[model samples]
Target: MASSVTILFLLLSIISMGGALASSKPSGSSDPLIGEVCSTQSHLVCTNYDDVQATSIAADQVATAASMRDASIQTINDLQEDFFLESSLVEGRKIAIHNNLNDPAPSRPFVPSSAVSSLPELTTYNALDIMSYFGVARDSSMATAIVTAAYLCGGAALPGEAKSCAASTKALAAFVASELGNNVSIYATKGAPTTYSTSTSHVKAPVTILKVAKGSVEEGRKIVVCHHLAFPSALYYCHAVTGTKVIQATLKTEGRLRAAYIKAMAVCHLNTELWLSRHPAFKALNIARGDEACHFLVENDLVFTRALQTSG
Candidate 1:
């Protein structure tokens, strides 16, 4: 795995090239930034239960990371703290990016109408040059967080899929409304959105997951999965998918009472055919052709579906 500095420069080179570093395609290969980051944190990817659970922890979480989504969900408060609240910067930056969709990697988040001030412009010759330009320490968490967000936002869209990065709750609402209409509800993993820990190996498998006795299990239609991003402020990389099914299940692992994890264990069953044959879900879940590969939503991910039955 390349160091964060290494990943940072990779993003810089892509920015300098000013081409499509990534497509809406989910394959790691589709996006260079995603590919490098995924390679660094292979354990966190959407692999099988054993692989995901057994994987070690990373120093920091990647935004829109191609990670395996399972495990101890974090608390809502933990999720809420990252937002910028009413800051106009969030909406301003997002709108700017949406307007200039073709600029695969934007250095400056310029907005003429925005009341916010101009932000620093990012540029570089290679991955390392940018790190040196910013004086970002090799161990700096920002090395990945900022660059990851940059690539995720600037990357291309998948066929028939619409994506956006919302830096605030208001911006998110607008994006969701634009994509799924107003009559929608968002279901996220209940409790705190937690990451798997070296200490909490107790949550690992060797336990059976009973029927999805809770949450919504509506027929396929339009569904949105918003992944929380790591940024200076709260940001989410959200994408809309069609013909996907969502559910919130509670598991009975090893006869222990359900942990106070996610309020609703939202799950998504991606259409297998539409996905690449090598998608982590396919290999991890042993999915057969023409079948769906279902997996738990990441702790930080939120699901937006038509308000079928609210998971209160």
Candidate 2:
């Protein structure tokens, strides 16, 4: 199993950016989707986003760096074992993220994914070479998505972590069954985070806990945050850490004219020790590396929570 970070390097602007199996009932086709998914983006505001930082927030889910999508990559990870260059990877991510936030964006504007699924990868990416890893054409709309998926697949799993990349809902169902079980419900949101006036300065997509989901809630329940990966095709990276919480809520963001309603989810990873101190999320959330961190599941990110058992 490959760690999410292993894929982050590849997933971040082509270098940037889950699960299981068996004895499992698949989440039916009619299975309610967490929220909504958009293949193309109208805007992208996220910058150097990843779970590595405490304040990682998605301005838009599907938006990403244009360079990541169009760049041709090399197979550096395959040939070089000593990849995961912390400095280089971080720099590349910053550069790509800046590109994403700047004007004259990609043909398809995207709201950058503040999908704080996991920390950035240790290695860096060169692009395209690994596209072969996911078995997709370079010219395909899903080219960037496929390569990112491949990076996740090829990542090396770390201790106390179970990881995978599901290309379809069925695949995601299988991964969930293996990791969690049928006794769970999914949650998500497609709305913007509630805005507030800050004393110092206005932050980008701050994490706001509007309310709790209408359902049975419990403490210490196992949870999996299935972040909608940036794939042209439907691909999801469902992630669960040792200490995580999933809260489903009916949230209404402070719209410009009127309030808009949405079913939103907030995922909090209690274990922040795994991330690097320099990750931007930490600063965004106003916390240190060792402190607990929380972020909204933006861009159609889903949260699978253990459901209360009922007698038939």
The per-prediction CA RMSD against the true structure, in angstroms, equals: 20.1, 16.5
lDDT of 1 at 297: 43
List runs of model 2 lying over 4 Å from the truth: 1-142, 190-216
TM-score of 1: 0.51
lDDT per residue for candidate 2 within 25-61, as digits (tens), equals 2233221232122111211122332222223222322
Q: At residue 36, give the lDDT of candidate 1.
A: 22
- What value does the lDDT take at residue 139 in candidate 1? 51
Global lDDT for candidate 1? 0.39
For candidate 2, give the lDDT: 0.38
CA shift at 142, candidate 1, in angstroms? 2.6
Which residue window of length 10 is worst by lDDT in model 2? 9-18
